[model samples]
Target: MTQPNILELAKQGDAKAIALLLNRQLQPKGITATAALKDGCLQVILEAVEVPSQQVLAAYMSKSIAGLGAASIEKVKVYGRQTGTKVPAWNQEFEMAGQKLPVADVSETRSAISTEVTESKPLSLKERAKLGDVEAIASLLNIPLRNKGISATASLQDGCLQVMLEGDPVPEEELAVRVVRRELTSLKAGAIASVKVYGQQVGEDFPAWNREFEIVAQTQTVKQNNNVKLNNHNHTLGDSIESDGLQEIAKNGDLNAIAILIQKSLAAYEVHVDAEIQYGVMLWLKLKSDKTLDSQACLNRVSRILNNIQPDKIVSARISQINSKNPKQQAWNKYLAFKEGQFIDNTKAVNQMTGAFCAAVVIVLIFISVMYKPTSTTSSSPASSSSTPASSSTSNSTTPRTFLGKSQTGYELWADKNCVYVKGMTEGDLARLNTDVWRFKDEVKLQTGYKCVLFE
Candidate 1:
């Protein structure tokens, strides 16, 4: 009898069959594979006596399952761990269905796994660096980057590599970061999930600005440090700190210090009274009184800067803002929420609403101006209409008007209003009566008795 195809059986949600096929390829050098299908998503686990390389395992799985033509599997979530470890060190998810092929996820996954294959021996230097060996990685970077007059230091906190650069001309920030990322990636550093960079003058006491290069779909929650010295100041914001001065404190990842600097910025805006700063799983700022547009604007700008620079620290930001001193004034509670895989701030809704209201008013004014303009012709008194031009030559000199202006809107208008007598007219010309009237009022000072005769 012929044997059934492993790929076909695996597609039918046969976890054991998928595990067997994976194990056959993995070939057990103290390594093993297991799979479970959950909610139309196949999860594959890799365990080894020695920790396994997540990149190697994930790449192998993508090539294997993608070639299998498994339409039922919508996504594949891989978990890698040591044989005795309960929690997985490496975790990532990639799509699988309806694709010609699956490429390895280029985004690094968090783990402390070895390079090459899993063996009973000790891990290599590159593997150690992948597991957050700061000294090892820094030493490797020091040599290459030293000749460029850039000193490099790496710190791992909450799985983010904070690369502090002290150099001249502050090598282009993003380029600096990408080069660092590329270098570390080439060396297979798996622990550095994302990089937060701080650039400083070589001889300066502090960094002037800092930025954290964001990660694709990384967790937004920033882990808090219990070691920060919390302040217990009264309601009024203390000495307002300059935003530029806070850059270094923020770069140092000091939550309490950052909050203090934020308070200082608020103070400078004169909204210090009744301001409350709450920190923990989330950063919340409450402005109970004396909030002006300038105050709120400055606060929002500084807070957003902090959140963008250290998303891991300020994972979520919320504010209850009130511009008036009255305690009864309703406060606007705004939040930063995720939408379509990016953050959409609800606070800006107020600004957008104000802008839209102004736009609506302008539109209404334009509509009224158009609608109120007379669309039909007006008849003059019979006495004036019947007046015959006894001396048509005398009338020509009396009404010898100059061409003051002309207009075209689906019809032509030539105004000869030197004597406030608009001579050019047709049935359609009546539609432009309002425009001509306004121009005549300003330019020719047209009065109630001015006559406009039809020329056609």
Candidate 2:
């Protein structure tokens, strides 16, 4: 009469009896035997009937299990043992069975789940500084860091800003010095004061994400005012160059002016530049300094500005600077002497210089390529080219090329004429098409594509 009674009957291996009972069904239209079978009632019926493929009986066995009645089970808290240790265990109050329970008494196969209590060991700024968190170091100096109000969020730690978050979206162990550098750059540039550090906790199966605070050192307005006076003096000189022109400027190589300019540049702080760009620009600049131009934070800042202005232009300017004042003076004198010729076209001289340099480079490359010609001595060897066709054939036959939709197949990678054909398909053309397809797909998915590559 009831579902459980029917279940009991099915358990007794009554396929015919079960079918007969179902034939006398009295339930809603939405409920069906087939639905019950799909919902795993058929297996139960098979056991009851002691016969597999009693499809009709099994099919009729399923329906809303609410008819079977409610479960008797209720949640209970199994308490943990307290050892009265001094280390304040971070625990929280919990609720079970409509009753508040102390965390100490709550337990099961896993520790109690609840909100975090305050940390027992509050770190002093000095102690946090030793952890190499730069922001923490700044904090020790009484710097005020901005807080976004997310606990376990990243904050200042010490000499380096340490991300102390647990369970980050990214794996914690993969974090490296580059990340530290990036955060430091942001701190230096006043972008972010702190970040979340992610890591796994001891004796835990899952990772934890934690927040840290940022504290940066600040200069008193008075100090900034004094620096501004010196900055104004140097800035006037830079502005002077605009009106007076580079020609009228006397060349004493005023060390004081240069030093002031360098210092102000460092303090003024411009766009953020990463280490690689810093290194490359420094190499190209070939600065006349025993002062270690490659490093020194001032140069790093200047390099960032130079890069922002235009990396290629900066590189070209530096190359032009080689031979120091001699080439500069010569070029300036030549320009003055040949003022009429200079205006023939705006880029006439620069274009001539660039063309000359290109010609020289082409000559060198051609010489090297000829000397190292592929056929210079390799003709006697078995043609490696002969085996390429076989491998290509196998690749063509077995490659699991996916159609992957419109986003997978279209692009003009590089432009030219006449492309090599693959099985009557132009390989280069297809490659371009594939790149376009991927770009379109990435655009649709908000994903990055190789063809749509971006760099900073």
Cα lDDT tens digits for candidate 1, 32-115:
666778887889887664567887777767766665566677888989886545689888888876666743221122121224
What are the clash counts of all predictions, listed in order? 3, 48
* lDDT score, candidate 2, position 293: 24
Q: Assess candidate 2 and give its TM-score to the true structure.
A: 0.17
* Among all candidates shown, the one with the greatest lDDT: 1
Worst 10 residues of 1 by lDDT: 104-113
- Candidate 2 deviant stretches above 4 angstroms: 1-160, 164-301, 304-456
lDDT per model vs. reference: 0.51, 0.27
Local error of candidate 1 at residue 419 (angstroms): 41
lDDT comparing candidate 2 with the true structure: 0.27
Residue 142's lDDT within candidate 1 is 53
